[model samples]
Target: MSETVPTPPSPTTRRQLLARTGAAGIGIAFSGALSELFTGTAAAGNLGHGGYGPLVPDPDGLLDLPKGFRYRVLSREGDPLRSGEGPVPSNHDGMAAFAGRHGRVHLVRNHENRATGRVPVPVIEGLTYDPEGKGGCTALTLDHRGSVLSERVAIAGTAVNCAGGPTPWDTWLTCEETEDKAGTNGYTKDHGFIFEVDGADPRRTGAVPLTAMGRFQHEAIAVDPKRGVVYETEDAFDRPFGLFYRFLPRKPLGGTGSLRAGGRLQAMRVPGVPDLSSIRETGARFDGIEWVDVPDPLAAGTPIRFQDFGPRGITHAQKLEGCYWGGRSVYFVSSYARSSEGSAGDHYGQIWRYDPDRRRLTLVIVFGPDTDVRLPGESPDNICLAPGGGLMVCEDGGGAQHVYGVTRRGEVYAVARNRQNVGTPEDPEWGEFAGVAFSPDGDTMYVNCYAPGTTFAVTGPWRG
Candidate 1:
């Protein structure tokens, strides 16, 4: 199979696209009318203070942030929940915040637990999908002051609940990053699917997997509000990398439970680009992109990436992690790639923005191999567009872990650092940051520490 690489867009056309989309070169596009979020925000290069200034060491030795910022521990592993079911689960990963009644905050959090963990999501009657599966989601209700009012099990009986995305109709899509079958791992049913959780009403969240969305090593997803199309990422790091997918649902914007109706899953095909990691240029653009229908979304035997796509094979990327919908484009992350791992090239990370309107994919940001491991631009995992503009990226790399901020100009700065020492004082260990989100009013930020399984509500003077 072969594909012809199209010529790059002209400079004038690139400039016009950027101007029309308000894409600030950093892959930062105004999400709808969110341009006001960056009104007075300083450019990444011009910020002598480095975004919000230097991070001040925390007295609690947990999370360090800029001066004037404060964080509250909303929930932790083994912490008893208000629902009286059991303790909070471990390995907090992807999360989303929603508006709650009476100015409260509703958060749906994922517990990325596999077969075993420090604490597993307790199985409830209607919420339990498989009694043996040890991963699921939890819902928390917090007051406006960042105080946890209630916490309960949203869904249970799922495996490897990794990163997921929020829906347009106010629901959380929790994905299982596993392909374990029922009989292989002491299971009863097939795994590898996406489940919808209702943060507002836990009872309404029946633990049902959207099978039509495809079954593979699922990662994060981005939902296009205009068309109700779901763009998903797969984290399969084997010989052949995972393919980016988009599901065209039978019912668009049909609110909750609509996705369960079914959809057609398709893989992205970027002409001559077989491996995305080979494209190192920051502004490299690929036009005339196409989507190939997956032979089998269920993956009854062969995985989607391994499945045949005819003469032109599907394009794949290494470590396709975070995904989010911004303006008219869908931004997805490739955490890192290595030649030793069968990649075409090597790089610290790359962020690609796909414009559905133009059927174009642009490499907006590329973290070179020389990026400082201690810095913010290395191996970005879960990501969310900040309410105050720019982006909040969770680091999942070697050395120190931090929640970094990226401006429209592509400048990187530290927002919060994980200082919690889970190991001995002599050999300290830090957990990666995951599930970075913001409240509806944009006053509070919610993030999680994947290790000790801690959720934090951070408040401070956010840049407007």
Candidate 2:
């Protein structure tokens, strides 16, 4: 049931990463970002000294970052889009940056809304899936100076567009975090599916759901470029939790529309381990992983997690959130687990690395229950490899939200703080940070504030 996989001898080791990145810290190295974070470097400690120094308070009372760093509001909920269709939607969750033509960067952002929001995604013709569904994605084109050139509705009429992954061919997979079906909660069509959104060109981002990818409380996904296999995570926490999934696309990497051809949806299973939260120790590994086919990927009746998976049931995890591909392995996150919530175990947070080549899943980082709620070590959501090295984790826990950075030594440092107080002066409301990603060139960092729905472009001397 429990095993320790031998660490591969490579630059992935913590000692090697420290040597490469240097103990004092250098500039951001995009190539070794993920390797530095997972390799022994994610031991969970607040090294308040090394990361870009201390965060300087913002005069505008919006976002606080280190000295010399500044942020600009790129978009906000109710802001009018360039298409003249409607204003921006609310709850900007997961986002990805891509290279664009003529020295521009395209950003595909998810709007995590449901039936009602402050500003709903406009049900535009050709882009809307269901007229009743109000969650979708927006595409923004930024110039070299990180200025928004144009903004348009990429996909619309979806529900709970939570977090999704970017494709190898420069596309974004926007996922619906809800399992609402027709006649439920005013949904005109069945929800809970992945829709491909093209950041560069909104015309290509048809609001068609990839039904073959399984229908459940979809959270996030990571596509393996080598095998053309897509790794997905379910965030259902009602009773049975959620299962880790993989979608084998029939046409691999053909282009943006390749996944529409249909594929096989399967769930992961570990011989003896049923719930992933049961594993507590860091560096814990499970080998010989198995995949079981889901009889109903559409989940027209029973949800995927409750469905039978034979004698050996599928493995499930609590609050499986952020997912991304790094260093030939797929990294997924369990935001937090609590026994009172029906989880097998309890933890502040955990990051797991799954190696397809070795067929192994290792717990690289584990946040203890005693982790400071105000710190960056707990409730990590919407993670991405920072262009400046290490991992950029968005804190979704209690108190003031922040975008924290984990160095190559597993040391946690505050990268940016959410200073926006949405509530009154007495009881201030801080929104959780989401969609933390860097530009392809690594010059600018893009993140979102979930509550008021604001996107910020952060830039500074990242070569600390």
Candidate 3:
């Protein structure tokens, strides 16, 4: 928070803040003007690099772990599996890490693959592995130093598990990134459901889909035990503007693993604003967001029904993707989906925060809609919070894909460049930032890249 920072005269007046941020970096502007605006005081804003800087690719390529930090590779695609199931399958995305006694840790990670003709490996234990098809969910045992002590294919015989979330009970909720027909031979598994895996439970069943979590092309999920609600994001690429969903479990409790039964599935409908017609897609930029509870969230289907009486169906230009929990609130992010605001492009993506208490949604940061901080054609696939109290966004599109960390006040920086990971040193290609998870202590981070993708355990100090 510096004295030179500019303050907007009014909420409608954004230029002063914009200029300061773009020209002066986030540090001075946020602390100076931002603090004053939010608290009527000018203090050092933790916005700018706070010491953290721009995103880096092949982190080892240009930089070393920050002071007091270290990292290791816990697992990567093509790595050998201990279960004699063969090499680790392709597409490592959405993951969770938890502590276990005896110097061991439980991990449940996802693989974005459809049930191929055969799934020799039970990604994890306790899975039906329907002959229809299976391709997702793997559980493992690891050390803090990033070594796989003993690994098991947790769940198998599923389809495209793109991204999922960590539960309070130390389990992983793997979500389907697409909706496939269950009747088809290779597509027997039903469309869109969240599966659970127990990293510590060696006897744990392979992987079992949480039919209670509902069915749809689920991208990610965020759980709130207090509310008995499980929030999820959808990646409906075939149908633009992915929807935001929530599962109101029939029962909400803190008994650890008691949430796998079933619940009501509801999609978010921005109140007051009507649904966007197909015509809105081509010219869409960003959806003017105003999230309201859907009436009867359980009665969700194409011809919708509800409890809150909100709008029905997905809006234009908002393929909902990526999510995280923060400030007693839940966040939902968007990508590629067109919006009327011109903010949905590779160059820029938007992050929206949903306050459960207020039952309201607000826009905290808007990036890339302009020339300055935009990615060439970046598709924000998924995201999680960083130890630095910021967000790490996974760029899942194009050749220059990378991970971006954004400060709470909206200063975006690239802490890691993944394009070169596992690629020929001289020939690099941008890949998808599929899965991300931080250790319980927030001292380390594990990033999984898709395609010849490698998972890197990165540890560092929270500079800001």
Candidate 4:
């Protein structure tokens, strides 16, 4: 199978990628040469000292950031829980940051919970896989000036968990978003999968699922630590849309990174784009890409992206959620698209970019259903890859919940907002920003609010 032919985007890089991609089709373009090369200058009058400049408004009103930045909530769902077990476990959502013991900084987080009694933890029997499934993962630690120093639970039960990724042998793949199964809705076991969480012994972590990594509904995951490949993401919000996976890993990661020693679960095909909901424009490229095998990566009820993998074609992405792996390519996120939800129509967010050395798959940023334009979030779900370079998104749509930051010349900056406010006086600060990581010496910048779950860090000056 060597018909290799993928080298053609060089008329000066396709005119600098058509002068930084934007405006291809699908009724909504944003104008001004794609909003001044990708949504920068959108709203945010003053506060740019590189970034983190004009936010300061949090007198304990939750988070606002900017001005020497300064956050550090560390952990807080129900609070307490410093390994004494109990409490500190709510929605939280995707997170990752490693390196601890002396230098400190472990993180790990992710609760997202999918029901079944709501919240409760302390079931570390043999590192639980589904005590009844309320979701799991905690491990805090911190300190190197970020504060906090203990908060445990690591892996347990496992259900909605949500976004995860950070493992070039450091561990923390989390996922689960929900395929439910097992005794139906009451769940005895059999939730959408992908579990591995150790981050250097987060309570001996091990609920093992990796079920060949497929299940559907999983959300975020991105790890190509030089070809160990794992890129998953699927929020699937209705009408057959949600795919973009890639597991590969039969054996390539040497030591104790452990992908459970099972792999091969592809899905991602843009060949001639049959019906990926018509590829909702924005920069819309989709060069070549191909990958199809996925008979049933533990589907149990069928949903390997609607499986059929025969002539090899599969494409979905409407709510593919977050995914990140910087430069060498892999930066997914298709958070919104709506033909009333069946997609291929009313998009509100996009951002693709795959490129594994020309296998191609581009669609760099799109968001049409104006939230008052100039880019300030609409549904851009959890993503992270901005140690000053590009992407940082996280704003599950709806209002006053930012954490944006696009730049790599694509502009868009509003970094951190969420003024956390729940009920009473009729709700307003609608918390959304979930797990926006960056702290392996990239200073500090952990996120997460997802409904009173909290866990900040922030720091200052980061622009690249």
RMSD per candidate (Å) reads: 8.9, 8.8, 9.3, 18.3
Rank by TM-score, highest first: 1, 2, 3, 4
User: What TM-score would every model get versus the actual structure?
Assistant: 0.90, 0.89, 0.75, 0.35
Q: Write the per-residue lDDT of candidate 4 for residues 1-464, one digit (tens) a residue.
A: 00011121222132223223432322223211122122222322232433454567889888887677778777778877977878887878788888776788888888877665356555787778877777788888777877777788888887777787887777788887777788867778788888888856754546878787777688788887788788898876565777888889888585454577887888877776754546665566666688877888888767777778766457675667788776477777776666644565666677677778888776667754333322354567787765544457786754356787654434456777877766443433355778888887777888888787888888876644
Q: Choose 1 or 4, whichever is better by lDDT.
A: 1
- Give candidate 1's TM-score: 0.90
lDDT rank order = 1, 2, 4, 3
User: Which digits, one per residue and each the tens of the lDDT, describe model 2 over residues 73-173?
Assistant: 99988878887988888888899999987779999999988786668899888999999988899999999878899999999999888899999999999
The alpha-carbon deviation from the true structure for residue 163 of candidate 4, after best TM-score superposition, in angstroms, is: 4.7
- Relative to the true structure, candidate 2 reaches a TM of 0.89
Worst 10 residues of 2 by lDDT: 1-10
* Tens-place lDDT digits, model 3, residues 29-136: 111111111211222136454335444333455223334545566666677777676677776777777887765667777777665522233443345456444566
Evaluated at residue 323, the lDDT of candidate 1 is 95
Which residue pairs overlap in candidate 4's backbone? 39-412, 40-412, 47-54, 179-192
Worst ten-residue run, lDDT, model 1?
1-10
